[model samples]
Target: METNLSATTAAEANPGTARDAAARHGALGTLALMIAHCAGMVDVVALPVWVGTLIGAYRLDPQQAGLLPTLFLAGAVVSSLFFSPRLNRLPSRVAATLGFCVAALVFFGLASTGRYPVMAALHAVAGIAAGCGLSFTHGTFGRSRNPHRLFAIAGLTLGFFAIAFLGITPGVIAVQGGQTLFRIFAGVMGVAAITSALAFPSLRPKRVAATPAEPRFDRAVWFGMAGVACMGLTQAMMFSFVQRIGLDRGFGFSAVTATLIALGFVNLFPAPIAGLLELRIPGRRVVLAGPLVQAALALVIAQSAAFAPYAAASSVLVAVMIFTHTFAFGMLARLDGTGRAVAATPAMLMTGAAIGPVLGGTLVKQYGYGSLGIAAALIAAMAVFCFSRLERRPN
Candidate 1:
């Protein structure tokens, strides 16, 4: 409490210039944070692309290849544990800027590394830095007066990037090879460092953790974390290996790939709607509805023989997943104004993602797609139950 006061009081006391500057920073900070996420996402997007490159270049087997992202996610989850809790306690500007700088430097090193052991180490370190950056970003989003809209914008931005990823990654891989993705990542990091340094103060206020706005954790807080974690678990499990499911269905590789690509449209459309509906719609309804729809759709997507139903099921699955996250995240921001629960967002997401492939792969290998689909449906049903526990608020 004593520590929190000094930092926030100092900012509150300097009302004129600091307030004016801080006021101007909101949108700029959002942009910086969003772009930083876009840049930091090399961990998520580059894995499949670069994994093949790593295998060919290093003569590594599939299991050895799997270690790349596993260690990277491990680094993120561990670092977020240590770093996210400090967002309110520490100087926001310094924390965010320093994180971006660390990520930039590590990614630069990632570009230059050649040895398999050394490259893995660099990627792991880079993941830690990226996790810190995300913690700061999520922490920033947590404090927004309208977290739903903010997260929606972030989701829509990701949607655009998903489209760009489809177009750009393939071209880069074809022309420049996989190492170029690291170079691109390094450049994105450098830009994020600069943007965060310039706009960090606008991101969020230097509010004290002990302030009335941020209360001690309670059932609602834990419930919110559990909800998002369940959300992450279901999505990652099926979404990670969805293409394999498509292939197993006997769909042509081109048709399956096209359906997968088409699914990107959901991110562009429904994600923003989920954000907008935060103000107009009750969070519980959207939250419950999202997984309900996903559960029904997942059953079909996991098993349907007809290509048309498969495509439709996959599209709706994508839509509801994004919708669930957008509204559920908004509900989290509302529950704990202090954003502590919100700070756990990335951890819940990355941890679930890290677990998904392993579990999905194992289930598919053992029992078949029917078992995997049933598993996804069950998890999605769980998310519905968990999200229902949230304290209902009027729209």
Candidate 2:
């Protein structure tokens, strides 16, 4: 009797333990999504720093410098739209792991290649590989039980990483010169490639029946996509040539480094707060705030020539831009029950970013950075109008 009672009690406890283990597994999977995304997200900021090398080594003008990021983003757009959609038949682990590995190799190429054409080509290829990894990773994260919460966590993780990199990378670059950006990029990609195999949790469902049509792209979805692209354009305009602008103002290397570190630390809160606010505010309003803030940044950039004021403005801009970026995609998450839509969202962002660099660079080279301010102001107003229309339209 005693033995039977003990056996029965043990069996009852097994279910709870299983539940606990499953919860832990899911949390780990969410963390993996963050790590995977962070690996890609760092590339944008890296370009501004790397431009120093391109200009010095290749005798390239600012307009030509823009091509590198443009091509990189173009590759991301192509892979996300055409390649990743086709890769759904592959197991998530197989796709994500392979893509990460290939991308890592390309990053190594980026570190080693000194020529302009070779470096550009390598980054474009790396972008394609990154897109595939992102597709798989996004799908994996979207399947989490608390996707909104997970997104908040993702935002928080990115903010923290941004801050840490801002703090450390400037010092590294100071010591190692322009090549440090490439080396750091390679190291980050290599680390991600190794860790990614274990980062993604299985997205397979328990149902024997067919899965629901989640991640649907209705009219609302397309509108949100457009908005993301515009946001990307705005971001590229603001960040890509900023180093040149700072140099023109006579800001020293130390000043730039200190400002970036301060800015990064400040942006850490806005992402998480934006997520929390999305729970209360109309989603459109939350997103609209991003552009308005960006416009403010443009004004500050145009008016303030000093490093102190510029630093303050840019830091706030980074904070608000990231905060809004999280919510803009959150709209997609709300619509995309299947999570595939969210996977494609990053591609759409890349598409806009691809266009932004060349356009912004040309404008800056011809009309100057002040023209960028005007462009951003106009774009910000347009974004507000477009978002208003999107909000009024029903799902």
Candidate 3:
């Protein structure tokens, strides 16, 4: 009799409870956004590895090699400003799917093209696609009811995709050659894009009721930009030069790549933890702490003679770096409280990413790899200063 009564009560509660659950899950809308983010990860993971090899194969100088990644980031920055806002007006699913398809095509073209100029152009196209993907995915997911969970899912998805590509791409290139790998990647991304397009919900655009626009040049935005810029510069430097650091330490190509891949693996698990941490701790504090930790690790790696210690330090550095940056993103979304504002965040981020490598490469030419640690430390200190100022401002 008691069991029957309990069942009846649960059944009576089902409709309201189920609706709440759906709201928490963000229905189908959140899944669509996650898929779009996963599609973008395919390129972000693969590009650094490819860039290193492409530079060697072309026998380009460091400056010339640096230009390739810079151009790619430049495209992202420009497209974010021009294309991202427009995507909000289009059907979200279609815009995201089309962007992924375009990126896949460009990736395939890049693999096929032998000439440096042609490859560079395709990379730029890929960057534009990346900008669109990032913009739309952030916009869609940020607006979801359960944004923190969605962001965590997005970060984990990106990290796993990165690890998979970093682990597999080199072996695939060795066994099947670059062209075949490109074809396989393109096909895979194409399928994902198509599936995302089909599975996404028909979302009615939310009306933005007119209000006084916030001042464009706010102190919060500038401080956020500085922190993001510092992180980007650090990442770009590490991405561009970590292999060289390994090689200089007498590690083999496979070992160097494996160490790099390990960083991505570490990244896979930390994002959700970072998201949870953001809820308990202040975002500025987390962001400030990350660079200090990274700088310390970089110094250890720079000075370490043994491969094991260097690899361990490097991996931890990257893991923490990603964790803090992902956390910062969540905080940015919280602060913005709108999809468009979140979409705009990447544009600010790309500016830092674009400049970091070029500057790092120049530094390398002038002072060599040993200077990288010191430079990173200084940049982190600057980020700390920027965040400190922002923290003092009245909300």
Candidate 4:
């Protein structure tokens, strides 16, 4: 009778324990998400310009310079597969905090390093950290209440952070050198990582209710992948050549920097607007249509005769791309309903993103900046084709 009573007591306590675990998970997830967004902005705005300048200083060819971005994406790809399963099994806060700590160290190393190879290696390490952090946060968010809303908020934050960081950091460093800029960014991320580690316990992990099994090869997944690829391609073209494109069109170096800053600023507003639209329209349509608009804008950019027209077209294209990509991510999580699946989506997206700059660089080497825009437009069109095929099938 005593043993039976003990067994019953233990069984009764399990539910409460599970709920407590869920609450802890959610808190870690939110904290992780914020850190990831901040880190992402810092990287997108600063890393590319820094790496590109480093490669140019070393007199490396376009292909050689392209390796930095490729390696970064490669790190992300490898880590995404490895990170998610491990994180899923660990305590969420512990996993997130550790990942951020690793990222902070890598950024500090990059800031201190002088050898090109070491810089590249540091970028790869940072990529791994980002991959792990993003996978954990995205996976956790997917299981939360109204995950789409949470994701949209995260996206908007990411955009604003990128605009703020990239807009100011690059120009500041443009007048200085890479080392100072990287150090500043390192300090910022270090503080963020530490704070995140401390504050991770307040939010709650969501208890995942059992749901129907998702299809293994859903059309929605493919569409989401295509949309992500298109967004990646657009970004690759813009970031890789925006400065050069401006200079070639007769803009001064200051004007080039200003143009980049303007693009970042433009990115800030569209994310919220896109998030709102995602709530009203089918995500498929938004994903499919965004690239088409971008393609049109790319064509205009390619054909523009003056700096004003080029900048105008470029800004519009960027704004549309950001909105579309943000919506695609939200839709991807909604469609897959699994952290692994959502994490896997970025792998496909990053593959395209990684390849895009290399392809754009090669096109520029062969033809020119005009060819780069044309190539991007063609890729965008291809994304539309893939999206259309997915749309014909029922959701």
Candidate 5:
């Protein structure tokens, strides 16, 4: 306890020392964070396959299928909102291990159930637990010496996981059904639980002197969070349906699955590339371009009847989000000195995502796939407006 206080005192005294301390545990810290990133963001790769499995194997309509993942993301958003502010008071490893353990158990339970109500409840439980763990992981990342580079490295790790997950899980679900998919989720949470227990670095929040003044986020932080949420919405809305869109358009199952694999391969480059270009490019320029590019890709994927256009657009859509969000993440970490704002990463991300699948399902049911492009355009406009409000930063 005395050592913790001393470390905290020193960290509070010098910001550079805090960053260097985080780097001192670099290898183990990075690996733990990588595993946590894969575990927390599993939804990115899992959602499409998950929703499709519910539709095909479980015999549900698009709305019902979409609702499950929405429930999971909503649960995450709620849990993140609750945990982000309290992270400093908690023991990082214990909190993370406990969260992942509960999530693992809930996922195992998810594997055993086919009932919609049961599965919905389990997903919410798993999301809450997983979100808690992720809050710790991202908060620690924000405390690092070079958060952008560290986050990019973690993003690269996630890209690798995406390839393995996208390559394997869909085929397994096609053969074995929803049970296999839930079991895979369980295994992921279990691994996260184990790795966090063994390797999570010591993290002590910087001490703020006691005062009557309230701690509040700057206006810019809210704008950044809003921008990320908008992008998240567009991403989930389009991605959740890409597989179904391709298949419904008479693209063969093999071709559609191949596109998913290709999407994974495409994902591998964006993060490292973003990391390398960090100093060369201004993040605001990237931020300004992100939503527009994302909207265009959505337009192409949604309106394209041809297999070639659809595949091409779908393959690279996620890479845009991954790349743009890396810059956004770094910028937010810099803007919010307390780390509390960046700790709300799960909330900022999953809040829009929570609404996306269900909203897309409703749109597809009511209008058609083309309506998604219209929606993306509208959301992108809002994201652009929000990002425009961001204060410029020097490289």
Candidate 6:
């Protein structure tokens, strides 16, 4: 009778314990999402600095310098594509923990070397590892009760991260050179590794059926992915040379860096604003307008020799993408019940980004900075067409 009572008591307590554990996971999961986003998307802030450092500090030519970041993004594209479909079968926490840990190690290796070949190899390795962690983080977000809000909050976190990174890194690199940038990358990855290992939530994958089966994507998801990819290409192509363009046009380093700082400040509002507008505006319309606005900004930034016009355009270039992508992400999350499309965020964002730097470098090298504007216009048209093709669903 005593043993029976004890067993009954333990069973009674288990439900409450489970609920408490779930609440804890929810809170920690939000934090993990933010940190993972910052570490994974650090490229947005770091691209100009990273490429500039290679060219200015390490004496690499423009094409060669651009190649390094291209390689990094290419690896990310590959890794995200590979892991997204398999997310349901994999242990999310284990994959995220090990992926970030490996990335941290590779970034540390990067900080110790200046050799182009060696650095290139390390960048590729780091990208692949980090991409794996990022895919799991996004997939977890999709499994949440409110993926749009959670993703927007994650974007807001990235905005603050940008402010700190842009404000501090350029000055540090100015005094300490390129290695400081890699050291910072390693530290960021290390924090992500620890965070993932400790608190990344283990949400069950989205169900496509009652029985065990693979989820299939519809044509709408493919079109959405392609649209996002085009925007990614335009963003990366212009951002990779932003600092260089300013310098080449006789803008002082201080002025260019100031514009970058201003850009960070501008980034803070877009995600929250997007979140607020989610219920009011149609995502399809927002996406349709995004590409055109992005193209106009690219033109002014690339063509203007005047600091005022250049700074104004450059400051908001990234904001347009952030705002638009927030909506795109929300739309895709709803469209794909299986969660795999959203999990492939890294691949969608980085596929064209992988081609961007190298392509932009070639254009700038051959035809000068103005060529980027023309390229952006062309890509924008393609992006607009792709977004227009997406089947409208009830927001």
Best by lDDT: 5
Best model number under TM-score? 5
TM-score of model 4 vs. true structure: 0.81
- Winner of 1 and 5 under lDDT: 5
Q: Candidate 2, residue 289: CA error in Å?
A: 2.4
Worst 10 residues of 2 by lDDT: 1-10
Candidate 1, residue 297: the lDDT equals: 73
Local error of candidate 2 at residue 23 (angstroms):
7.8
Candidate 1 collision pairs: none
What ranges in model 6 sit over 4 Å off?
Answer: 1-25, 204-210
Cα TM-score of candidate 2: 0.86
Candidate 3 residues 32-145, lDDT tens each?
Answer: 556667665443455455546555555566666676777777777787777545433456566667777887788777767677788678768877876776666666555555
Tens-place lDDT digits, model 6, residues 274-393: 999999999999999999999999999889989999999999999999999999999988877546788899999999888889899999889999999999999999999999988886
The C-alpha TM-scores of every prediction are: 0.80, 0.86, 0.83, 0.81, 0.95, 0.92
How do the candidates rank by TM-score, highest first?
Answer: 5, 6, 2, 3, 4, 1
Candidate 5 lDDT over 56-141, as tens digits, reads 88888888999999998999899899988865556777788888889999999988888989989988888999999999888777
**Candidate 6, number of clashes:** 0
Give the Cα RMSD of candidate 6.
6.1
Worst 10 residues of 5 by lDDT: 1-10
The Cα error of candidate 3 at residue 198, in Å, is: 1.9
Q: Is 3 or 4 the stronger prediction by lDDT?
A: 3
Give candidate 1's error at residue 315 in angstroms: 3.8
lDDT of 1 by residue, 1-395 (tens): 00111224444443212222223235666777688666654444444345444554455554455466656666777777787666566666566667767877877777676777987797778778877877877766676556677778877777776666644654565577667767777777788778877765433445554343334667865766766666666665566555556665788666765665676665688778886677788878877777667667767877787899888887556567667777777777766655656666767676765565556556665777667578877787777777777787874
Pairs clashing within candidate 6:
none
